[model samples]
Target: MKKLDVTYSANIGSYLGVPIILEDNTMFGTLCAIDPSPHKFDKKDLELMQTLANFIANAIELGQAYEIILAEEQRVKKELELAKKVQTSVLSEPVQLEKINIQAYYQSSESLSGDMYSWFEISPNKFGVILIDVMGHGVSAALISMSIRSLLKGLITSISEPIEVIKELNHHIFSLFNSTHQSTYATAVYMVIDTELKTIEYVNAGHPSGLLFLDQKTMKRMDEGSIILGIFPNLKVDKQLIHYNEPSTIMLYTDGLTELINPVINDAIHTVENIIIGEPDNLQLIEEIKKEFVNGKTLKDDICLITVNVE
Candidate 1:
């Protein structure tokens, strides 16, 4: 008798009613009665065949499931990368103004960031600057920040007052997030400086208080607006007015700069002012501060600084 194992045999036997198998001990075909049918195999033999087929089917199904999971993961990763690039591009670069000198820097903590800063020339002399940080970081936060930027850009040309700019923006953000159960918020500081009048008007919305250096001797912290955007409906922020005459520097920044635990805010501010007082150049001032407090270290949070020298 020849060996007749399912693993070895490529063809089925003509006599299907009998169970044919080869024992491992010897290469001899053995026959056993699987179903009591004289004509052909019965339901019992058919069931055994179906059981084996099911095992192969299960293996194929598992392999397909694993492939689907891998593909979904890869798709999500690609989408995140694209979102990061779009968010970074939406934040404006160092824009040159005709009358005013502008030096600005933005460092994203992650591949995607919530922090956004934009400056646009409303006219030759009149310009608009916005510094904003969404509630969190990553894709969701980056999307919120991008939405805020779009809303601002559309409304900025029509709105002249900083408070009005914030009010309208707050309404748009809150309304958009209300239905989706997506509670998104932002902290922002906006300013419009009139170079001819030498007056700076700003509105702050739950962001870090900005710095106004008056001849290096007098330093005033500006904190005007009350609530964060998207928290309240029809939010109203008071616009604080400051007059900058002579050689004065207005420092608009995010909280990531001051919240450092090691150097501390007081020590950091001292280090920045010491270099900036004598050196009037905007580029030189930021370089000195970055070297001293930041130490060329990679930032954990997004850091944005906009220094405007009133000329």
Candidate 2:
């Protein structure tokens, strides 16, 4: 006390204080009081001051904890936004060729999507298309989708067959999840089109079947495939080929579109089939489907749709 500098005032003569310490043995501040006259505090008075200091320390700790929680929440929110942007930017745009027309629509139940669709030209007349659904929602699923996109982009350059591409993807996903002791799965459909041959070769990995519309009155669904990817390393992917003699529309979609709840459309699949057969153009079909199934209500899962018209 003698070594410390004191500020003498006319009215204040004495001061009493107790250190406010946190649970981690860190000092937050001091609980202090001042008196106008020179005074000596009793043991009871000191005890009371200690109790008040403990209370102040607890309050300070709580405030700090709350700040940390708030910061974490904001960080998560920003990460989700960034994830959404990354996922959206990776989606393929509508492709128009001399003999083929492609259109796609995508929507997520949340800010991040697990569903993804992509298509690119494999050769001068050959094109590769894929649709995938990771078995979850939000950031984790979105990350997996992004990884799948990267893998597909690299694989498509070397592999021209849909079955071999799916096999490689399954092997990669299986190996990754097995090493981490985590179980994650995804359903996918991949198709490769040869314009010169007028044929489509495709493989489905536990996803819903894609429809082949021969005309307004004739249609068929491609339903042959294997189990979901990442379930096992040794998956037998069956590849199917179809030769189209005339112009046809092939539609691929996630289960979210087939499971939508609409009062007017009792069966979502039937509604989609009706639109594909009835609508004259792809844009009208897309707009009509959105109006019927997705305009007003929140989706229960991520929705992805891809239509390829071969002429």
Candidate 3:
């Protein structure tokens, strides 16, 4: 060993060092020892030093693994945030027209949701609205929901009929899953409203029945269609028509709204029916409904609601 300034100044006599090498043969540093006076380390001392070096190496490796884990967690969190933003951006905004007023509400149980909805004008006086709920929650379901949203945006442009649109979507989703060998499904309700004719044509694909409030004490349920999408390739869905003779309200929602824990499903539906029967303003009704599922009560799944008031 060279007599460096530090060694000479400190009167170091001997040194023992072992490289802290990882399992991948990457060197982190060195486990070293120095002496201030002339000394000789015996065979036993050398073996003990080697053992300590091994311990140090293991600790260092564990620390590095922990750092890697932390970095991966941060990356996943950021990706989830971005996904949530994209999902929220795709949701439909409230629609206010001369003949109808519509409002929608959505809430994700976690960082990402599987519920989605859209509303657009098909013709000059005709409007199309759709609500979809993927089978599960989280990133996978959110991605499926987004894919369906993109497909529907294109399908609605060409297919004006609700049943046809659902058929096309089901075919596409089923084909995609068949090729990928992954089984996934979604429930949806698609509706088309004609202002001049004062009629609504809709098809429900295994989703919860929509509530049509006829008057203060009267409400009609719309529950006509085939099974859920993505299960079968060639499926036929039936479309139901409602000809409104007077002012009315139509409520479309996901099962999450009525599938709460404290109140049973039937009771929750009754509660919502009561709220719709009493509340006149759609926005106020949404707020009240939200209150029912809040205050330390976590949602079991994503919640979505669409309210359309026909005048």
Model 1 poorest ten-residue lDDT run: 18-27
Whichever of 1 and 3 has more TM-score, that candidate is 3
**Clash pairs, model 2 backbone:** none
What does candidate 3's lDDT look like per residue over 151-257, in tens digits?
87778867889989999989877886798788899899999988889899999999988888864346878789989999999888999988887778888999988
- Summed over model 2, clashes come to 0
lDDT of the candidates, in the order given: 0.72, 0.84, 0.85
- Residue 235 of model 3, lDDT score: 88
How do the residues 87-126 of candidate 2 rate in per-residue lDDT, one tens digit apiece? 8998998988888888999999999988999998898889
Best by TM-score: 3
* Order of models, best lDDT first: 3, 2, 1
- In model 3, the runs with Cα more than 4 Å from the true position are 1-16, 33-40, 261-263
Tens digit of per-residue lDDT, candidate 1, span 5-116:
8513544443442222222333223233342222466688767765555564555567768999999989988987887777777766664445467787777777788888
Predicted structure 2, TM vs. truth: 0.81
List TM-scores for all candidates, in order.
Answer: 0.71, 0.81, 0.87
Once superposed on the true structure, which residue ranges of model 1 sit more than 4 Å away at CA? 1-77, 215-217, 261-275, 278-280, 293-298
Winning candidate number (lDDT): 3
